[model samples]
Target chain A: MSKEELRMHWEDSFDHKYVKLKKWLIDGMTNGQFRFGDRLPSENMLCRKFDLSRQTVRRALDELEKEGAIKKVRGSGTFVNRVFAQPQRTSSVGILSTVLYEYIFPTIMFGAENILTSAGYGIEFGITYNKVENEANFLKRMLEINPMGLIIEGSKTNLPAMNVDLFREIQRKGIPVVFIHNQYAELSDIPCIIMDDVGSAFALTELLIQNGHKKIAGIFKFDDVQGKYRYAGYGKALRAHKIPIVDEHVIWFDSYEWLGKEMNWVFEEIAECTAIVCYNDQVCIKVLAEMKRRGLSVPTDISVVSIDDTNLIANLEVGITSAVHPKEIIGEVAAKTLIKMIEDNTVGNKSYSKVMPVEIVVRQSIANRKKMEKHHE
Target chain B: MSKEELRMHWEDSFDHKYVKLKKWLIDGMTNGQFRFGDRLPSENMLCRKFDLSRQTVRRALDELEKEGAIKKVRGSGTFVNRVFAQPQRTSSVGILSTVLYEYIFPTIMFGAENILTSAGYGIEFGITYNKVENEANFLKRMLEINPMGLIIEGSKTNLPAMNVDLFREIQRKGIPVVFIHNQYAELSDIPCIIMDDVGSAFALTELLIQNGHKKIAGIFKFDDVQGKYRYAGYGKALRAHKIPIVDEHVIWFDSYEWLGKEMNWVFEEIAECTAIVCYNDQVCIKVLAEMKRRGLSVPTDISVVSIDDTNLIANLEVGITSAVHPKEIIGEVAAKTLIKMIEDNTVGNKSYSKVMPVEIVVRQSIANRKKMEKHHE
Candidate 1:
């Protein structure tokens, strides 16, 4: 079938001017009117053929391109996705989260579902609860369901490999897999949507430094990929400022200890520091509590800042001056990426990795220490 | 079947002491070994006959009762649930929440899932995002699915009637409905698992009074059922202590406006109050930030107390003294009740309404104003 034939079919398929042009493209591809590697009608050609706006034509083409149903080259016309042209559309995508309905997962799931549903896909979720047994159970269920694609927010991305074989098996079954939040260390070839942890942390630490604080202590988690990047960023900011990165000023703890009894020691160790750089809002909030317990005032006796500005943190006593978490956008991008991989049959290819941008949120947590010193003098 | 025959079956079912007795009971009914309203063997008789521990027998019976497979009448033997006798087991229950990922919802959902899954039921969640349209959409979807039961965390419980007809329709389909956190005004016949808002708030306010606070101001949300109860409790505490509930000291705002510019007015209005009683941790945190900006020291220039002791409040600049939210227990109780209603086919019979207890968390936010006055003298 030629481009002209496909154009005629699209125009004849509907009476309304607002006919779904994207669906027509998919229908053409499935019926062999547009075969693998066949060039789609140019945007202007599509607009003229269908009597549609250029914007409408481009939008349809863009969606097709996004889902791997079509790929656009800089100088060449868009081609049908070689992988997606043959298979029928799968009704549902499977999503696995460590803990559903908690912290940021619900919003992420919500965002993903909104986009996926609009694109004619349903979501089936399984909870791993950050446990190996639960992970195994969910993986087994995913295998049974054999969903169109799988999106995993792994239970512990840094742990010794456990579900590597299962994930590999999923890929072997022709199901696309995309990881979010944390990716498995062993599966480096898989596409991932991860945070710009190092850059965001570096920016956050630099913000504190720019606020005139020299003695900045850090409270970080040591059990995941994010913690390492955040800690390194803190060190980088200190090095750039020519401030000594003292070993005793750093407190390395896991998620379990944020509100745990070890908080007393964390506060005691950071006593002499003028500013505190925390890993996330949960840790920062705990540090603030400890500061209050010791009769220390925030941004006065000591300043504070962290990464991931959550709602709880935003509405806190000082509305934590920190970095914003792009959870919704991450979900949307990750969902779109996975769907594209599924459509194009590019699940096994190590062709995509996204590090979404993070921005600073200026609140009341940080203080100008130099001004305080001047006032004291 | 006779008691002897039932015991014989139980003994022959498995070798492991930790056998799945609940499945066996369901199987017995399906296979015609048990019938509707048939009285089962006494716990002691079953224990003696099957050579099983009384604890195991009771445990199995307890689960059967929760799933509405049986009922234990005082001074009589346990009888099979009449409604559960004929229908095949439904594997899933639907849950709807206004927002699923924020605040204390994650923990509540976690608790509910733990109980439901253990009892062999799956959860299908719908998020209303606190919008009427979304609520209607979810309700329509739930009706199409015709789930075994429904657990609703309403969009906005205090709003004018919108979902009452949909809820009534669910009951008409013979599907049980249970509400959590808040209940709709028109659906008085449905069971609800709500917080003891008034009692908890009274306790919190009484605590502040005991600590020598007389001039107490409140920042409350007026758009939910819980807020109204909490406000009433606050008033009750004030009146009981002979402290006037001043009009200017009370600031009423909605959930949408908590982080809005109206907050500036909230801070400005509460300037003269020595102690501020907040709606929840989120509000308390905001109030604290405002105090910091105005150079008012917590427990010194002013004191604070609030409802719902969340992680944010626990780890604040001043660990807010608060009334705890029983979200987890509420979820557990609500899920169990809904399951019972589903199994027993009691969709419209008002058999349950639970108000889970709340306790006070004494932290540093509340100060002894009388003691401070004496010290200054």
Candidate 2:
């Protein structure tokens, strides 16, 4: 069919002019009007035939070319290619998580899916399960795919170093990468989305102190970067309140398995304490269970508080008072900032990071021992 | 400086041809060698002078042009524009959540951020706070930003319809959108990442029955879509064991606030039951607290179990046995599916949904009442 004939068959129901033009061409091709090796109308011809701009015609044609519906010869003209039997794999973004099915990671992954998919990009996902070797392997595999961008949740980022050169190699290859939750010290040049762990931890400790708790115990993770910062905040809060950092009251676990095996250490730390500051809800639960086994009640015998205002704490009848982790905002900000870097084509150009603010959630796990003292007096 | 002079000044340490060219141009401009509004050497001249291909020279020029360092007039050669004062705002992806700072949403937001940012796209976030009006307003506001794509967590999606028209309008406008958690009935055409609520709830209920608890009470939410599906699962489990769905033993709460005020209902329901099935950890906690107040111990007087394998129950001394929620996997799959739709440009073209798999976490809350009866005999 002639270009004019094809233009006349275009539907106006579709609001997008490019979409309408695209549909018309697709319909004509499907009906065998446009065949293999057939030369389609030139950009100028289509502009006039459809009463459209050269830009609009070119856009429709560009899409057609991408889907292998057409091909262009530099000095010649546009010719119809075969109708694609299989869809093409376009540009993609990769997301590497330490753990894929636990805590906040799932939601973060879902959030990323929402943005990337809508923007017409594919996703490549990998799980490190918080292991250094797994992270290395995942990064290597991701490099082979060479996605448009990469999102990495660092594994054991609290350690002095691991996989810095691998991350640098990705940058050198012109691929944009952003870190989530934690980042390595050697990879300081990389942008990361992090929680305000220090501040929130400090606030949680302060909350316990305000309730008249002089002896406090702390449980922290040794492998994650957030644990270090949170511990720092814990120390700051203790120093600020004129309470010495009690060495015996502090415990650090390397992994969940380690924590499970070292339940005795938790007991040792909490023996002389009136309040306990846990690394997260998981630690809080373990400590609570142990306390209950020994016939100790929450807040009355000793107050309990932790960071991360998750359902774990929120679901309790008398919920564990917590300092909120700005989980969603961290995801949003990190995605935005990284995208800005990629679009600006300045990946590896400069370091950018965001520390999201947190809030304290008050609940029944924290009690005012001062009130009891007044009754005793 | 002339093209030959610039070529002679090129450094050997820079690996990328574009990087070398960019650095040369920047240095020349800063040193007044290439002044404001000055025209640069032609692409052919640079290729010849630097012993590079025309493609290489052009690539360098493209980078310079993107940075606003040079402008090419229709007939005129490329000339210096100006140093970029600030980076431009690139295309953005939008995320609309029911609540931005709440438990699961934050992590989801963070995950999305990790993906979007790395791909070189910014994020525009909005929160519905689980209110229909808020959802409508956020959707409308998101339209104003004209994001490349959208990810929405539906607000109370079980009641048939609320924002169907608004969501349809978004799809009609050619913006890709994917839902998380729950989807409205009228908008079934849109894809959603959901949990296997029915199967998981059934497993949880079956667990209680397996422990010889014939009388099982239930607490659920009325507004959220998951509540209904979970309730269905609960009934199926009971019927499988030939236990009637006791009307008085099932209580549904609208909001967390409602659950707090309706403790009496929970107490009443559990009065004659040997076990209870809660919608989530929050309800489980409330029941545990009430049970404690009445001097009732878990798995002794009554067994308490819930869905969602979060730290809330995990941290308890006698943790609540739970059916795990595939939180991170949900995000990953949802984001992947949505991206597939967008990249294929099939927005509103097909219906896609994924019900993530779940696992039951066995904890100490459940007791084998059959053994207790044998002991009594």
Candidate 3:
């Protein structure tokens, strides 16, 4: 590299450090942490807090002084200027969810980020790992930063939430929050962008019944509202057809209990059933693997159906019948709703909360039980 | 009193004590503070915590066992029954605000309570004393109860908020929250039922300008969004009329700074002005009293205009021109909005967040500068 290029790079680094330190000081004043006439931290203290050199800290302080945001009293240190200490607004929104890489979350995040960034707003992303405690911590951190809006997916929504008070406080502070996927039963007023879980589950179950498959079994997650809604849809479809919901054919497992378990027990409970409805593509893959282990051919010995038409089942010889999750579209809608709330100051409007319809994709997963019996005769 | 009557009264008191203890235990179970199969507190612990006799605590435990909510073993401690330990939904809403007795809050509360109670929903009321810390404490307590919805008047809304995370957590939990009067700038999506401060302030200022008073002085609160909006309207009116705003003639104070202060300095800064615009009727009262102390007559020496045509200024000899505060109407609308959100599950709709229009209540305080000049001629 040329000497000029090296100097430019060094200067850019120097400028970045000072600009960051200057913003910290300004934020302190804007948020009233440093009120007018209040003394600022010493040069040594600033350097330690921001982890910058004394020269960089001095440059930041100098810029503040020049702009009249602070006054330097050589003996007394720096004080916020009574005249120039005013609140500054930020155009950033906080985006929080359970996980980014797992399931369809990456697509959702990508869709939301694209819209928010293009609209000239910065994003502060947070992950909760589906824990209420982590959600509270992230929310607390976000509130301190005071973003203009928020788009969040709830953590363990089917359970009694422990972090709802913090959510209420955020609303009280006038921040617009929009939820994607699921929301807590306690905060139904906050708009949520979600696919029609019940309808999709119903459609998947109906597809199985239409193929002359009766005595069907279902495996569902018990700790999330989405699972409950899907179960309800399955039950509704069964009831509509005058089919008795045999308790022995239904199984429930939470997030932690579903991993690396013996599938023999699950199959044993539903041994007499002709078909099974898995909760999603992820669960369907597990069921398919378990069937293969038992030397059972898909749509020959047993049939399968589920929700979320994701690529997880792409490599399987038989494509499982499933309903679309509307992954990216849900994210885009959530982001758009949040942005509308922010720009229009209509965060209180419940109309923006929407339920997207689902479409089912049929594959070679279900068997024609009636046709097979007639051919045998 | 008869012997039977006296005995009945004693029995009623005893029943109430045991019933309260039973309800407390059920609440703990329903809110997941105690999970299924969790051991119950010892009789001695319950007695001590509830300040009840051992017999009353034992009776409460017996009731739980009879209702199949708990199982008590002869030698072992009592345990929550796995089958019966399910979440029991409450038909109650939490109402939070600052200073229920001050200004128009009592009327607002009355309106909300009337509607909520009539709709068969119970009320949980909390006061914040306009402090964010108190707001947080109340919010935490309310979240534990997990009310169906929340109607809150934000505390210290003009300043940087400290309890917004709690609010966001509540929203994530699916509780609907509505704000009244003022809301924090950070959470603008939470529907707020408020009078149009900007429009009213403009009309009030315009009334002064129409009376031929161009050199106008104004005083506003700086810590509330309402104050900022009112100030905006005042500025807008001045700008529209092509009048330069004299910086020295305007003053801003927060909730804390406005109490028990001398107004001589205020008058000194605006001595040349013929009329002063006050933020609210409360501030106008203070200003009027100061004018009277200085032997200045209303409309003769100086005129005043303000918002909130409340009963606080009813006893004044000279009626000050002001804007009407919706008061109970705001409360009714807030309650209706909350109930709609709860019943229709439309809390995410921004259309419900309303800005109530303001009307000017023409009183006797404005001085006609043109008429006074003609009289002098």
Candidate 4:
């Protein structure tokens, strides 16, 4: 056909009533007004809404089905198709974290990067240093990039987030964001991949209790949800064992207060405790350093147990009995969930949130106080 | 004083009427209610608000002045001191950008990093890749970190920003943010260090017009404010020279569409023009490659002019006359401005926004069309 004829034909086809109806449906799905697997309005409803004829509406629906934009499930209704609803403009995923190279963050990032790169998607990565302000900045940048999906390790998950509006805006724009490690309570509808902090801390505390250590002191972080959950677990274990939970035996520190003086203060508060449960390996290491300075030996003077079985604990003279953190697994699961949501064009699908179970890694850090008592007798 | 005596004295001192009034003033400054250099309430107003006697209020003002938290002028009321208002918690600043390694970004980052590091402040860095989503993400992260200050190159600055709330929140928290390169129109209140894009583009285009080329084709980016300004300058230059602006000779492409095929399409649109003005060095390089593919020689066949005098143009077989981008200088100014704001504890101060002047470098790209016409005769 001549160029003029092609133009005329294109204009006529696009100007058709059925084609206009189809465009409206596509626009709705693209904007997340109609998400993946969502049932479209009844044919009669669409016809009335668009002021179109029944035959035109049916034609539009049939055309959409042919194009894989929707599926008609026999007797039910037409549903938005997951695969076809995806706007594959850029094959890139945004990955955000509080810390990229600290503690277990590197492994988590590596895990997510492996999955994303192997799937032929580029990565836009950022770190927030566990600060809500930094999280807000990174989220704003992510919104500008408009990646196919986002996988983020939330910052200060224990606190109320001021960036919930940004998260909601992202979802409204049809870009799925999956939380790794934890999520904001305000945005609880978003899917997440997280380790069971409460369960892990419970198991760790129980192990110490099983070793006959009743006088246990807990050192926990106050800024993150994981820390709160771990503290709860510690309290739960002590309660279950009928041990008195002394206020003086609990030491709470935020991200900024983990200094030499803070460690000394922690020891002073828990001076009479036989065992200590730390928030993480970093805290455990600090406590151990303080013990060493005081010329005390682990398991002999005081037993130390913590969560996050990082390599930092392995380098120590004495092994720390702790609960394992699913670092890389959290990243991998988060990436997979985000990719699924992106491909399916689903927004704020809570079904994808997975809390992995916990496991204890026994080491020499825990001492059997009951055995020690028998030996003394 | 003895410990008990000291405690008693502290309680007595703090419980005094003047001390309570002093605490309120400090709190106002801390929360950004009273900014640096802002005039505090009059002594009479403070007395009325606090229901304190004139002597008590005078004592409070005297204590504040003695501590350098506020300054009292002979005729005016006391003002918040810039030096004393800073909350010196973390010695770090966050630096955000759209691209880190591309074009002039590295040098710009280097300049800022040098200044920030030399000042004994650590850096928290992130990039948004010219995406609004990424900008939102990074801004959120910056907010969480609560860095002393933030230096950022805006993402998709020509468009309406969805991250303005995030920026406003950062300011509300009293964390100063300085924009490098360009800023969002919605956030015009934020300080920025940017080059004169409009004047530079105008000069570049006028240079071509001065070389006696009238039928000039222009290729410009559509997504950034820089592109819009550059296009405006180009049109202004054409109009100044009494050259009729032809719609067919102007081409607009966004961040996503500057590929080989797009360049070919651009050329097809401006096939009749004798010379071309490009958006930047990157676009100019692409145009050069396309012309080479078509076996057209620069200057001998058609002259090319562009902005951003990057090293890429220096390596070309033929030199292309372009405007200098002030790459590193932009970074230095941004860093300095941010540091000043941070130390002063000022938020959203527009006076710090610096629009650096532009300069053009004459190269071998332009052909003397007038000379060619006379030689043909």
TM-score of each: 0.40, 0.39, 0.41, 0.45
Better of 1 and 3 by lDDT: 3
Q: Give the lDDT of residue A49 in candidate 2.
A: 82
DockQ of each: 0.01, 0.01, 0.01, 0.01
Error of 2 at A153 (Å): 0.7
lDDT of 1 by residue, B1-377 (tens): 77677667766766544255667667776554675556778888767766678889888888788877789999988987644422453568999887778988888998898889998888999887665557777888887776788898876464333556678777655678888888766677788898898898889888889888887887766556677678778877886786755656766555444575345666666667788888888888788787788788888888888887888777666777888888788889989998778666677455688888778888888788778878989
Highest TM-score against the true fold, candidate: 4
- lDDT of each residue in B117-231, candidate 2, tens digit only: 7667677878766666577777877666656677788875643344566676666445678888887766877878778888988999998898788888888775577887787
Q: At residue A215, give the lDDT of candidate 1.
A: 78
Clashes of 2: 28
Displacement of residue A241 (Cα, Å) in model 4 is 46
TM-score for candidate 3: 0.41
In candidate 3 the C-alpha lDDT for residue B220 amounts to 78
Total backbone clashes of candidate 1, pairs 3 or more residues apart or in separate chains: 0
Tens-place lDDT digits, model 1, residues A25-124: 8788776578666788888877877667888888778777776677999998898765342355356899888777777777888888888899989898
Regions more than 4 Å wrong, model 3 = A1-377, B1-87
* TM-score of structure candidate 1: 0.40
Q: Which residue pairs of candidate 1 clash?
A: none
Q: List, residue by residue over A92-191, the lDDT tens digit for candidate 3.
A: 8999988889888899899899999999999999997776657878888877877788998887565445467678777755578998888877798889
Q: What's the lDDT for candidate 1?
A: 0.75
Stretches of candidate 2 exceeding 4 Å from the true structure: A1-90, A348-351, B1-377
